[model samples]
Target: MTETEVLAVAGQQAIWACLMVGGPLLGLLLAVGVVVAILQALTQVQEAALAFVPKMVVLGLALMFGGPMAMSVLRTFTEDIFAQMVSVGGLR
Candidate 1:
């Protein structure tokens, strides 16, 4: 493949990997936000901390739980990129 083609593929893979790695955390936080919003509306709780704390808690939990898997995926992508870079003759 041409240089441009290889770079394009690498870029696409990087984006995909990022989405895949972050998608779960993003989705979880979104769901939590929606639920928290609804509860606040029902209870008439106007405290900003109410909306913020749960997200922080969830984010901590997600990273605690998902950190290893995310790291593995990122490592794989990085390794693949480096390996390809070497195969391509090392940065011209």
Candidate 2:
């Protein structure tokens, strides 16, 4: 591929990798936040901790469980970049 085409492909792959790594966590947080908001609205308990605690707990749990998958995505991206570099004569 030409240099520009290669760069475009790399950028697309990078974006895809980022979404794969972050999408689940963000989606979970969105769902949790919405539920918490609805609950807070219904019960009329507007404590700052109420909103923050669940997100934090969920984020921690997600990281613990999702770290391996995130790492795998990153590793694969790094390998693809290196392989592309070799193919494009940018690496020995």
Candidate 3:
């Protein structure tokens, strides 16, 4: 493929990789926040920070669990881009 086509493909792949890596954790955090908010509303707790801790915990755990996979995905993308650049003589 031409340089432009290769770069476009790489850009798309990077975006897809980010989505794949982050989508599930973000979705889980959203679900938890919504559920917690509904429960707080029903109970009339109305604590502004009530959802914060749980969301933080859940997001932290998600990151911890998914860190390796996310790193691998990012590293692969970086390596691919570098390889393409080298192939195109963009890098010495």
Candidate 4:
């Protein structure tokens, strides 16, 4: 495979990695936000800061749960890119 092919593969892999890593956390954040909004509406408590803590906590937990997988994906991508780079001619 040529350098361009390697790079294209790596780029696509990176994009996929990002989506895989980020999707859950983003989805959770959205869910939390919606729930908080609904609660605020029902209770009529317009405290802006109320949403902050729960979202942060949920997002943090999501990241903690997902962190290992994310790191593994990133490591694999980095290793692949490096292997390709070595095969393609040692950093040009």
Weakest ten-residue segment in model 3 by summed lDDT: 83-92
Query: Local error of candidate 1 at 63, Å?
Result: 0.4
Candidate 3 residue lDDT tens string, 1-92: 78898889888988989898989898999999999989998999988789798999999999998989999988998898888888877654
Instruction: Kindly list the per-residue Cα lDDT of model 1 for residues 10-80, writing each as its tens digit.
Output: 99989989998999999999999999999999999989999999999999999999999999999999998
Instruction: State the lDDT at 5 in candidate 2.
Output: 90
- Pick by TM-score: 2 or 4, better one: 2
| Clashing residue pairs found in predicted model 1 | none
Regions of model 1 farther than 4 Å from truth: 90-92
Clashes of 2: 0
lDDT of 4 by residue, 55-74 (tens): 99998888888899989988
- Sorting all predicted structures by TM-score, with the top scorer first, yields 2, 1, 3, 4
Q: Of the candidates numbered 2 and 4, which has the greater lDDT value?
A: 2
Measure candidate 3: CA RMSD: 1.4
What's the best-to-worst order under lDDT?
A: 2, 1, 4, 3
Tens digit of lDDT per residue, candidate 2, span 2-89?
A: 8889899999999999999999999999999999999999999999999999999999999999999999999999999988888888
Q: Estimate candidate 2's alpha-carbon lDDT, on a 0 to 1 scale.
A: 0.96
lDDT for 29 (candidate 3): 92
Total backbone collisions for each predicted model: 0, 0, 0, 0
lDDT of 4 at 29: 95
Per-residue lDDT of 72 in model 4: 92
